[model samples]
Target: MGTTLHPLNPSDANLIQARLSELGYYRYQPEGIWGLVSRSALQDFKAANGLSADDVWDGSVEASLRQARPTPASDTPFGEWSVVGFACSAEMNPRKMVVSAKGIVVGSMICDMQGPLARSSADWSGSVLCHIDGRDIASKISLRVSGQRLVDRSVIGTSTIVPTSFDRCS
Candidate 1:
């Protein structure tokens, strides 16, 4: 018997669809299905990227997708910032954080991480697993600092959750 090929999962399919859409390869809603529309889009992407037109979600396709969507970097968030105040129900003091990029330090500020820093897509929204004081914590932090406005949500210490927005300090 020969090995069988399985269809992409809904989540993976959605991711591919979204990336394709962003790259102008797909023009349909991301319904998380590897149907004809998705296959055609994938083929187009492969042809455009000079890859084999297999119309399959292979390693090469995934790599191309990743290359198209890079993570947001610290340099993208560099600049003097005005804190918009944080809202939390628990007691916790603000701590300092340093943003850096490509081994160069960018900026530092007094802010609560509430969790460890993580890099998501250029869109800057996702969930990350953090470990604090030997304890594992899962938090959802949305950071969109590439633009003039920066927004963040995180949990500090044990129970303090803070949502903060910052604007460029002129």
Candidate 2:
């Protein structure tokens, strides 16, 4: 198993810890690191989320974090932007999956993660329903651009990654 816990930034750790806490796995200060508190928190999170009792980060584990409902931002942009690329790394593991999409900013991008079959979790995927400037993007299927690879675009700040299949809409 290539699972290793990396030191998380204070803010990132706080966010992760907070998320875990919200899911009823409280056990950390949200300082964001592999300290005793975080480790315990991870253990709790794993058990609650139906993951291995071991404190390791796998796709399913990370998905639980990512699937947490996000606080609605003041400005949400939900529409066809076009799936360009997607990249993700398991929280405990350093490896990442980069998915590239066609350069078309469609309505929404949905992703269904086919996690390792060994893990006992549904292959999770859904569309990001963004609310931008009071407009609803609703849902749209995402298209794979150039396979799983990084793209020149940035997936941070004001971007929502929804996991939907790549199917054209009317």
Candidate 3:
């Protein structure tokens, strides 16, 4: 979007990386450096869109990218998600989740299930039957993919518990 032109500086490179990532060609987080990863992503985008693979960023690429639509989180093949959440001081280790392109959600490495994807004006989510304190309650859960290292989960499972994020699992 900037008029800085090709041979983009770090700031422009960062912007390009962010855009490319949104288009699903870049995997790593935007670091504001025009490195190999950035160039590769750009090249891939060009090839996909039938642009000349000159290994350079220019107005044509920018224009096409600007017109491109972002892929939904539900469509992306998510990574191996794990969390050691604490339930009443007991560490709930091995709690995991993974979403595939076929709409299958594998979780805790023990759960192989898929729930209907529900969309609202606020966000995208699906319901998973959670067994909390002995009752299986259908709970709302959202999974968001970002960069390379993280896929965030926001659980609006029950009114009794606050929406929980399990992103800091080590």
Candidate 4:
């Protein structure tokens, strides 16, 4: 079987919203709703990228969006983050993650779903997937890296993990 995408799902919408927000298209929080705002942003993005401004999130549109992500500066999520949080079945806690531009030096094992940061945004956000037993599990992980803080949210299976926020450690 192939991967199926449900555009209406909040998790899926969150991913789309994060990508759009990173690309300078969407301006509001990624609340995961297919409203006029989201449609307008998608249309604007399509028009700018030489695609028909239909506001439809299909395979073609997704492919285009994936290609439009900004490259990361380095292959790691390092430097001092102002805020950081982690959530799992057993425990949820606020923690400090120490990583570098090269890769993860300390803290939870995390990396960008995309390789590097080719583009930057004011309120940039991205998605991360959890790998268990060498398989990509069906979990929703989102990260928002802003001026001095980073917010991480992980939803596993059908359980919602409360979002964890972190600030860049000075």
- lDDT (Cα, 0-100) at 45 in candidate 2: 50
Q: Which stretches of candidate 1 lie over 4 Å from their true place?
A: 1-7, 69-170
For model 2, the superposed segments whose C-alpha errors exceed 4 Å read 1-7, 68-170
Task: Summarize candidate 4's per-residue lDDT along 73-163 as a digit string, tens digits.
Answer: 1211334443434322223222555432222212444443332222244333234344444555444444556555666554554667677
Q: What lDDT does each candidate get?
A: 0.49, 0.37, 0.50, 0.52
Q: In terms of lDDT, which candidate is stronger, 1 or 2?
A: 1
TM-score result, candidate 2 = 0.33
lDDT score at residue 53, model 3, on the 0-100 scale:
40
Residue-by-residue lDDT tens digits, candidate 3, 1-170: 44344435777778888887776666678878887767766655664455654466667777777774633222332333454343322344444444432232333322212443443432345555655455555655565434333344545344633333433221
Q: What lDDT, from 0 to 1, does candidate 4 have?
A: 0.52
| Evaluation by lDDT, superior candidate among 1 and 3 | 3
Per-residue lDDT tens digits for candidate 2, residues 6-63, read: 3355665677677765553443345655566565556545543445545666666666
Put down candidate 1 lDDT per residue, 100-131, tens digits, no spaces.
Answer: 21111112212323322334543333334455
lDDT for model 2 = 0.37
In model 1, pairs of residues that clash are 114-155
lDDT of 3 at 86: 35
**RMSD to native for every prediction?**
15.5, 15.5, 11.7, 16.0
The candidate 4 region of ten consecutive residues with least summed lDDT is: 70-79
